[model samples]
Target: MEKHSTLAQPDTLASAHRTFATEIAALQALDARLDDSFEQAVAMMLACQGRVVVTGIGKSGHIAKKIAATLASTGTPAFFMHGAEAIHGDLGMLTRQDIVLALSYSGAAHELLTVLSVVRRLGARLIALTGHAQSELARNADLHLDAHVAQEACPLNLAPTASTTAALVLGDALAVACLEARGFSREDFARSHPGGALGRRLLTRVRDVMRQGEALPIVHLDTPVADALVEMSTKGMGMTIVIDDNKQPAGIFTDGDLRRLIARHGDIRPLTVATGMTPGPKTIAPDALAVEAATVMDAGRLNQMLVVDDTGLLLGALHMHDLLAAKVI
Candidate 1:
């Protein structure tokens, strides 16, 4: 039992090391072989006015699905097709305007090749990522990328190993190139993934979430300290705007101001709203993004701020608590 336990862990570690080494060597070979064909593949994808169809067999098929997803999420439309299914009715998914990306470590996966005739008939541009340029898939493809590796990490040198890693990296290269070509932006990505927290953080606008109009806790610049305190308490936002007769924001009265004035004067009534008000308060536009408002608040070192219209008229108020409760932070 002792010998068996000792042998098992070391065997697993050795197999892992061999696998990593083989995959690294395969990526190195693929890196060395990058040439104009890669450029042509990107150009073919860029020219496609339709989706990109990714296909493979076995482990390659799993990798192909991931590649397809990445492409779709990053501004390029893409879908995965099982190579064997293409021989069935799935070939109908392909259109002349689309581009086909084929994957095969040996460059001769039979299931993948079964659709070569249909690919030509569909007139879809073909780009092959393979380990052998002379293989049937490469020979038939309109563009070919070399995915060669010196050896497999397997004891028998038969596992997919390095070849699959090389294929995946090459696929990533294609996706990123197309992503940049299309000028994909964070906003675009957010639209593709609106359900995630990141999407809300980036895409949610201030107008969508900010308090507005009469909901704002506001006091006129002429308001007495007692009345201003009433505004703050009733609004429950911890602060209130003090506006001039023209309805433009003249100052802001906060809980901090009330505390300081009481400590100094010992009488809240004798201090008018203007006396306790801060002359210049940080402000935001109602149309700004919620994340941007959070950034502005943090940068100014304040917990609460006033929201205004583009022409400087007071529109609403926001507190750091609003952001925290909305999970914008």
Candidate 2:
């Protein structure tokens, strides 16, 4: 095969370092520029009776969409409307009760300006994120957030690198501030993100994953140790629960206990499960979060836990493997 010489590569690592430095400086400047306008913006969004509509174009539009998603997931109702699409017909998504968050690095994008005009006509509020304070969009907005940057990370100083980073961080700040103001809890966040790992950890209860009904390995206290071992093997839980007449867990016998019992005494054939079981094993409420169950099991170095009700009646059992299967671990 004919070979062609490759072009010499530039100092890519140095370029990346320079980009990081530039963006960090831009963020510091944006942080220092934060003032009453930011406070008012948060208050306005919190007071909004309708959704927050974020709109922008080009690179700014991507940032706007992310901001809208973050706000919606963090206890605020928000959505993105493309600037050009809004001018054509998507503006109907907005209502007088809604607040428009418009982004344009130059503060002079024509499509954003058109959306701004319609926003005013509809009696909706407008918040502008732009690099220029004196620009038309900034001047006309009900609130303006300055996302100015000294220079782009691009060596030519023309691309939207530093400016976009500043805008994105500013948007995150707004979302988090609103989230805190609304007192959004972990459960609330889990509700919005039901398909995510955090949702499984926060929203799933012990009852949702614990083994119950025929899957439980139950043996009476008077049962033979060999019988308890059979129940444990049949249930595949590595342990058997010793239950009383009231179906309350009296004790638990694990494989470890069986091993220790054998080591302590050579004659095991005459013993009942009571001689080898661990009494008053750790238990948790069925309604407790699965992650909480995991914490308790981890703290005690236990593999199995009994789920009970207020009256201490055994409802089910939870193996560490169950949490792993449910992805709550």
Candidate 3:
């Protein structure tokens, strides 16, 4: 039993190595398969006036969904339709202006054949991604992409393994190629993925989310500590900015400073903000990304920050909660 247990570990490791090796070889084969056909596919998608509808069945269906999402999020407008559902009225989603990209490893899923015929009759172009170029799905399509692999990673060679990986990588290749051909920018990607963290990092500017104007807790340097506390309380930012006569930041007093003041003196109400303010506080510009502001606050162990202009004048305020609300954190 102990000998068998010891051998099992090496057996599992060998299986993993074999799986990786097979998939890598399959991808290499796929890379070599890329030629003018790949370029033609990309050009067709680039010139598409409507969405690219991706459809497949079973495991291929999952990959189809992901490819559709990748295309949509990267500037190519696309959505997934189930191959099985196409005959059940989901075919209404296809139009003459649209292009259908169908995935079927066998090149002949009965469900896909029926859907492909209907899509063709609807005047939509078809791009077939299949392992068999001689198969019906590939033969009826306007474009055929051979996503064939030599063998499965499965030890039995019965499961869809390396073939699926090759199909997925090919889908990614098509999406990225189309993305580059269209000259899609990061901002364009952010627009499509507005609910994600990448969108927040790319699109959310400090000034767009900062509290400014009357919301600023600005007090003169000569303001008493008690009055500064009132301004901070009214603004609800846990801090107050002390401005010089030229409307520039002279110093800043925060809840931390108040705590130190209370610990050092029994009566801090009589002292001016100048006596307790921290001089030359860190500031950020309005045009900076909110994620950048979050980075500054985190590096300094700060909970709040002040926004400023080029001449050292205070413009607005930023709190950690603001970054949180903006999803920039």
Best by lDDT: 2
Between candidates 1 and 2, name the one with more favorable TM-score.
2
* TM-score versus the correct structure, for each prediction: 0.87, 0.89, 0.84
Q: Show the lowest summed lDDT stretch of 10 residues, model 2.
A: 242-251
Higher-ranked by TM-score: 2 or 3? 2
Residue 29 C-alpha lDDT in model 1: 73
Instruction: Give the residue spans of candidate 2 off by over 4 A.
Output: 1-9, 263-270
- Model 1 segments more than 4 A misplaced: 1-15, 85-88, 185-202
* Residue pair clashes in candidate 1: none
Candidates arranged by TM-score, highest first: 2, 1, 3
RMSD of 1: 2.8
Pairs that clash in candidate 2: none
* lDDT at 133, model 1: 86
Per-residue lDDT tens digits of candidate 1, residues 1-329?
45544553457777788788778877777778788888888888878899899998888888888899998999888999998887788988888998888888777898878777788887777888788889999999988888887887766878776777777898898899988998999988989988777888888877777888778888898789998888889988888888898989898888898899888889777668898889888888887999999999899888888888889987788888888878778
Q: Candidate 2's residue-wise lDDT over 1-329, tens digit each?
A: 99987988889999899999999999998888799999999999999999999999999999999999999999999999999899999998889999999999999999999998999999999999999999999999999999999999999999999999999999999999999999999989999999899999999999999999999999998999888888999999999999877778999999999999999987788999999899999999999999999999999999999999999988999999999999998
